[model samples]
Target: MNLKFIKRNIFPLVKIISTVLITSAIGLESWNIYAFLTNRNVPSSLNPIFWIERFAMTSHFIESIIAAFYAHSGKKMPIQYATYTFFVGTIGLLELFDQEND
Candidate 1:
């Protein structure tokens, strides 16, 4: 059980786990919105559609944070790091648009 070998194996595992968790969170958030719309009445003051959009955007923000962490873990190749960084930037832009609408 060399410490270096353990680290080498664990870090990539962590990145994969992080990516899966982020994707799951996005899916769950979307499902929540769908459930709200299909089964319940919408509130008059806050539009359910807009609220769902904002919630989805917030989930993207969380996904961006996960991507940033995975990128900074220093376990991935340069290309992988760049790819995660690009996702983070795209999520941030979506969040900004959501904020502007609210």
Candidate 2:
């Protein structure tokens, strides 16, 4: 119930949850792409999921590029930062910011 404890714990927990959700989504989208490639029958209702995944991937890729640029300018390892950004989204950016600040 302490505010400090909640502040310290809740944000990391949220980040972990978001990372898991994103990873699961990526897995599902990968499966969908595989199905499409293999000519498997996909239900009409699920067709939009592919497009949604595409958009999500595009956005994440762009974010990763931005993170790479930021990392380079910060004299950090760009690929490492970018890979984190690619998989975990803006929480990685937040971590980069915190490290740079330190």
Candidate 3:
């Protein structure tokens, strides 16, 4: 296969993957926060789950901001962004369903 073709395809794929991952992180974090708030006893900050939830929320927020900037500029974003968005979005959706099932 030609290197050029691979490069072209890879960039788009990357963007999608990133998106999905970021989105998933956000959803998972949100669920964690909700569960904590609803519970009589909140989880400690020192807990690993707390850290994971925080990171996931932060990642999602940052990715969303970047995506907004790219979209508002009316210019095509790099394939990396697209790939990221796709992954994040997918993860977010999955998280939502997972929470619902629980």
Candidate 4:
């Protein structure tokens, strides 16, 4: 088996899948929020769960903004990134192939 070729090709697939998963999650969440906004029967946005989610998302947004600034300075991340915990499995590629930057 050609391990090197498979190794080289796997990350792009992982990235594309991760991105799709993340996008779908966001899309689903948007639909939820839209339903809440449009239907008075839905729970209030001020619910504790919503506040907790808001804080979590805000923290993640801050990290991405920082990472974007770092990217602008031509310094790549020293570690791998994943959009969600499910995607973290893809980080194994870093250890398997020594691709820590990008």
Candidate 5:
């Protein structure tokens, strides 16, 4: 197995999957908030997920800011990297690092 080939192909696939999964999680968290606001009954099992999702969202926001800073320092488009990092988290940051390396 060639390492470059795997990094070029598989890494992008991983990023796409990560973005989808994270976005879906945020969507679920949004629903949880809406449910709570509308006085809907939320299951006890989901209570834990609600808190976890909140933490994840906060972490991702911070990561996005870091990504923007990195991109700006590298003379790349900060907004693009920041938006991508917001959706894909660390995977997007990894990609930015890889681009810098290249």
Candidate 6:
């Protein structure tokens, strides 16, 4: 593939994918956090079937929150930050950092 083609395609593709992933992450994390705070989430129910998902979500939430703080404090973005921000799913830290960088 040509550099020109890649340059045109990849950035836009990345933006689109990142936007979608981040949005979903925010939604899911928020939902899980709410459910968790109220003790109504599946994890709280102690269903074996939900354990993996709960564990994954919990970890994701933890990572994302840390990433958010890191991004907010003007630190470099780690690959994990992308994962976290994507999971955090809000529109704040990413936009803040993007504007700060620009």
Most accurate candidate by TM-score: 5
Residues 59-83 of candidate 5: C-alpha lDDT, one tens digit per residue: 8899999999999666679898898
Q: Rate residue 87 of model 5 by lDDT.
A: 84
Which digits, one per residue and each the tens of the lDDT, describe model 1 over residues 16-48? 665675566566557667878889654555557
4 against 5, candidate with superior TM-score: 5
- TM-score versus the correct structure, for each prediction: 0.39, 0.73, 0.41, 0.45, 0.79, 0.42
Q: Candidate 4 — what's its lDDT?
A: 0.49
Backbone steric clashes in candidate 3, count: 27
What TM-score does candidate 4 reach? Answer: 0.45
For model 5 the local lDDT of residue 56 reads 80
The regions of model 5 sitting more than 4 angstroms off are: 1-6
lDDT of 6 at 90: 36
Model 5 poorest ten-residue lDDT run: 72-81
The better candidate by TM-score, 1 or 6, is: 6
Residue 15 lDDT, candidate 2, scale 0-100:
66
Candidate of highest lDDT: 5
Superior by lDDT: candidate 4 or candidate 5: 5
Model 4 error, position 61 (Å): 3.4
* Per-candidate local distance difference test: 0.54, 0.78, 0.54, 0.49, 0.83, 0.57
Which lDDT tens digits does candidate 6 get at residues 1-102?
A: 896686477655765665675566556667777888997754545455245545645665665676656664565465556464545433335444566677
* Residue lDDT tens for model 2, 30-80: 787788899997677876876786777788789889899999666789998
lDDT of model number 1: 0.54
Error of 2 at 11 (Å): 3.0
The count of backbone overlaps in candidate 2 is 0
lDDT computed for candidate 2 = 0.78
Candidate 3 Cα lDDT to native: 0.54
Among residues 3 or more apart in sequence or in different chains, the pairs in candidate 6 whose N, CA or C atoms overlap within 3 Å are 25-87, 26-88, 26-89
